[model samples]
Target: MDEQPGLSEQYRRVSAWPLFIALGLPIAEIGVLFGLVPIAIGGLLLFVGSIAGIVQESGYVERPWNLLAGLGGALVVLGAALALSQLPGFSPGAVLAALGSNGLVVRGVSIVVAGVIALGVGGAARFVEQEPI
Candidate 1:
């Protein structure tokens, strides 16, 4: 195969990030629609990780920790709002029931959880930065 002219190292034509990114959202949605916890969690993890990876690979950031943390923070806020919006009232029993039976609550909670995970991962990644010699 002849190499393409002017295709330098900075030009990325192939990457695994897009594949996982494509798969993650639908998988998460499927889980949410069906009220499946594990699938939703897994899908969210894949989705967030892949997003950070793709962003870094595309040269948007030398380190994606800040990006992931920002995303996580946004998710947490949005999820809380969504969950609260779906609530009927503030009764503890009602909340518990909603968590168990309500799809919207489940979706909101899942998003919040995913966001926390992303935030933690991002915070942890920040400390693991490679120091140039």
Candidate 2:
């Protein structure tokens, strides 16, 4: 039997990125709704963060949930159109118009808060030795 101290820290750091996305997803979605220029980039980040969170050992924390939420948001903003485009050969600019914007301050704030909390939890988790408690 063996335990690795670095494992928890690694997971915590990896997970933090997802929380950042979750925080940003709302803003990105809003941008999509507003027809802004940065929406696509924001949406891209959401997708990347979600995919990463889904695959990585982020542990059960805000980041993992955030990733899932971000993915859901991406779908809400443009999933159906993409599917329709494949079927009838139709396209809408909504797919490319959902991303970061000046109004994303709210999302940025949430992401920072979630990140701080997750870091604390992950840090605390690391300090707790893997043993019966």
- Which digits, one per residue and each the tens of the lDDT, describe model 1 over residues 24-83? 989987876776877876787788788988999898888778888888888788777777
What is the overall TM-score of model 2 with all chains considered together?
0.32
Error of 2 at 40 (Å): 3.7
Candidate 2 structure quality by residue, lDDT tens digits, 102-125: 233323333333334344444455
Q: Give the alpha-carbon lDDT of every model.
A: 0.81, 0.45
Q: What are the runs in model 2 whose C-alpha is more than 4 Å off?
A: 1-14, 59-133
